[model samples]
Target: MKYIKKYHKYIGLFGCLLIAISCFLPFIKYSILNINETNNFFNGDGKLVLAINIITILLILFNKDKTSLISTVSIVVILIQNILTINKDIISIGKLGYIHFSIGFYLLIAGIVICIVYPFLPKEKNIS
Candidate 1:
């Protein structure tokens, strides 16, 4: 816990970096009519998510309470929006392969989870 508290900011920064990198990786994959298709951050609202993540990185660096809260809320909203739309947009056809969330999607969720949890971690104790 002590180590986490001391390095929470860096952890958050790492999460933000993961998010930024994930933006360029394949996010979703599905097959329709025997053809496979993959989508990345640039295809949908990914660019917006990336932009918000950049703001989150700045907020984490600044270490402002209110700003962090705002960024967390915004990230949650984006996550929810993506979850809802991904389900809605993918049309399931009989005999077609199932939709799969690729590496980028998981990485994105992981990063968001880290960011959301960082603010709640206990503060470091003073040894002196």
Candidate 2:
């Protein structure tokens, strides 16, 4: 717990990095109409989510209050959108294998989770 409190900012920054990277990576893999295709976050409705995450990261970096409501709201919105996209049905008459989430989707979800939890972590004290 102490370690987490002390390193919370670093952890949050790492999470932000993950979120940024996920924006460019493949978000999902599916064959629409039997045509193999891959899509990244910006390729679809994920663009808004990406923008939200960017704003959230910026807020987190500059805001003194780690537990700011806006930060939480942004991450929550991103998470909700990712979950909805994952569950939404698409290409029903395609291959037997169901649509699978790519690494990007998982990364974004994980990053958002970390960001949400980081604020609750105890604030660190002066080390010097």
Candidate 3:
């Protein structure tokens, strides 16, 4: 807990970085069509996720106050919503091919989780 608090800002930054990168990676793939495409600009909700990550990054860089914490929580909510929506879309495509969630999806989840959790950690102890 102490370690996490001590480097909370950096941890958040890393999560933001992950979210940013995930936007460019393959979020989902249609095995039948061999479509291993990136999310974000092309398809899916990666663009919004990336946008939120950028906002979170700015908040983390500029302030560690309640607003930043609130934004992180909001981002997590948005991320989860996107996930569910995508799942629903996938189901709607039923039998279109073997749908496989690629690394980007997992990474985004991990990143959002990290971003949300760090805000609630106990403050670091001052050694000075």
Q: Candidate 2 on 1-128: residue-level lDDT in tens?
A: 88887776777777777877887899888765666778788766566766766676676677544654466467667667666756656444445556778998888878777777767778777678
lDDT of 1 at 82: 82
Model 3 Cα lDDT, one tens digit per residue, 1-128? 66877786888788788777877877776554555544442266666667766778888887563456676677677767876876886788777656667887787778777777666666665588
lDDT of 1: 0.77
Q: Against the hidden reference, what TM-scores do the models get?
A: 0.84, 0.74, 0.74
Residue clash pairs of candidate 3: none
Task: Give lDDT per model, in order.
Answer: 0.77, 0.71, 0.70
**RMSD to the hidden true structure, all candidates:** 2.6, 3.1, 3.1
Worst 10 residues of 2 by lDDT: 88-97
lDDT of 3 at 64: 64
| Candidate 1 per-residue lDDT over residues 8-76, each given as its tens digit | 788878878888888889988887777898989766777887788888888887775346757767866
Model 1 stretches astray by more than 4 angstroms: 91-95, 124-128
Candidate 3: what lDDT? 0.70
